[model samples]
Target: MPNIQLIAPCLWFDDQAEEAAEFYTAIFSNSQIVNITRYGEAGHEMHGKPAGTVMTVAFELNGQPFIALNGGPAFKFNEAISFQVICQTQEEVDNYWEKLSAGGDKTAQQCGWLKDRYGVSWQIIPNILLEMLNDADTTKSQRTMTAMLQMKKIDISELLQASAE
Candidate 1:
């Protein structure tokens, strides 16, 4: 592991760290729950959690380390930061879009972005979207960008057709 990844991202949840960790592990491939720590009687007064209640969950998603904290509802997820899942095929994009967006805010979806049930935003983007949008031909790139702007989940076929010379 590199020093950069040693500082893994920590996600905050309102008393749902274990549940969220389980959900994420189930969704992403090559993932597992590493460890879980629960609150004890030693700090119940400061933490406000009952003894043995889950305080933190450490897990990895697609080999990337992550920590889920059972923090209170003083914070909420917004669009300012999001994890980007770059996919090589439409099938991959569609699968992630369907699973992650289940029970999520549908109206918030636009241009390959969706907010999961936990309110964490994700971008299920097709790798081709970048290639097409970055094409040397300005017209094709513009067309590809326009087509991408019209859909919630990325469609590689449409993006390819839009960029066709």
Candidate 2:
């Protein structure tokens, strides 16, 4: 039996598992590809994948283990499940937003939420968002929520300005 780690997110892709794994490893710190599994003749007929084709890739993103499966086009990524990227600064948020949104569905981008080229939804959140939303005063949090809903990318300064109102 494979020594599987407790629980790790598995991303499904249409023959782009290796590409997606490479993309994510480049995006986050403390990341690397741990292993890659290829299909073999034994399951070629059952899986319908050619021998030697990539089956899965195990990788780490910000030290979190994840697997990307080249599971074909029977399924696709949707917005129902999204990965939240908590950033310490607006620069971090902007950088990720720009990188992740490249070649993706730009029309679907709003409220700091965007689908990457792989159709994977991601939330690029500013760290201050938590503090703002958790403020002791509900009005401040409400105002912050209002500000957040108005923008495509989160603006820390703007959120602060709204909280001040």
lDDT of each: 0.91, 0.93
TM-score of each prediction: 0.94, 0.95
How big is the positional error of residue 95 in model 2, measured in Å on the Cα after superposition? Answer: 1.2
Count of residue pairs whose backbone atoms collide, per candidate? 0, 0
Candidate 2 lowest-lDDT run of ten: 39-48
Whole-model alpha-carbon lDDT for candidate 1: 0.91
Candidate 2, residue 43: how far the Cα is off, in Å: 2.0
lDDT of 1 by residue, 41-78 (tens): 99777778888889899999998999999988889999
RMSD of 1: 1.7
**Residue-level lDDT tens digits of model 2 in 37-147:** 999899676678999999999999998999999988999999999999999988999899999898899988889899999999999999899889999999999999999
Clashing pairs in 1: none
Give lDDT: candidate 2, residue 34.
Answer: 96
Query: Cα lDDT for residue 98, model 2?
Result: 90
